[model samples]
Target: MVQTVISVAGASADCPEWVLIDLQGSLETRHPVPLSGRFVGDLHFTQKDVPILIIGHHILYGKTVHLEKPFAVLVKKERSADTSMETDQNVSGTSYHVKALIRRKLLFKTRPKPIISNVPKKL
Candidate 1:
């Protein structure tokens, strides 16, 4: 019988804090383009510790929610299996490591409102 072996990567030394943002409505762009590395919006906190997200001319009210269970972000580790000398032991498969841990999220469930007043050029 043939068997497959999978290897697991080690945990990250520094577990960065990760927060999930839940938007009720979908974002529609004028043109179909990649949103990666693009400045989406600004997140501000009120005196009561509420979250407000301002994108374009729309403003969304949100609140912070604590997750019941935390999530771990995993990243695949790249390694070369080639060796100068062949050995009886075989190399393990690719592995992944925990990049970050998420314990909280910002939830925006209400509909966004258009900004009627003048917005500041810079915050």
Candidate 2:
């Protein structure tokens, strides 16, 4: 039987960059629904590379921090092969591959502020 070994991808320039964003708070939905693949907000950067997050009518400011221990995003891959023709035994196994590494994170610990429009009233 062929054995497959799973390991994290070495840190290299070819690896895709990944960043973890911490809101420092819990997210709540209106009707307690799943939030997978949902549109949350837009993240913008200032001239000094400071991160600004805009969610609905609230705006939050955050900073990037390096993690002490990096995290690896992995993907599972399965393979099936017939090991013996007489016995017709199938060899199936799964291996994980590192997709990306999270070395830094954007942290928004402070409370979000409301975005006010500065529109002038006409007489």
Choose the strongest candidate by lDDT. 2
User: What digit string (tens of lDDT, one per residue) describes model 1 on residues 1-123?
Assistant: 222333333554556889999999887678998877777899999999999999998999999999999888777654456641352334334446677888999999999998886766764
Worst 10-residue stretch by lDDT in candidate 1? Answer: 1-10
TM-score of each: 0.70, 0.66
TM-score of 1: 0.70
- Writing each residue's lDDT as its tens digit, candidate 2 over 9-121 gives 77656788799999988677788789998879999999998899998778999998999999888898755454334332343266788898889999999999988867685
TM-score, candidate 2, is: 0.66
Q: Which residue pairs overlap in candidate 2's backbone?
A: none
Off by more than 4 A, model 2: 1-5, 9-13, 76-95, 116-123
Residue pairs with backbone overlap in model 1: none
Clash totals in order: 0, 0
| The candidate that achieves the highest TM-score relative to the unseen native structure | 1
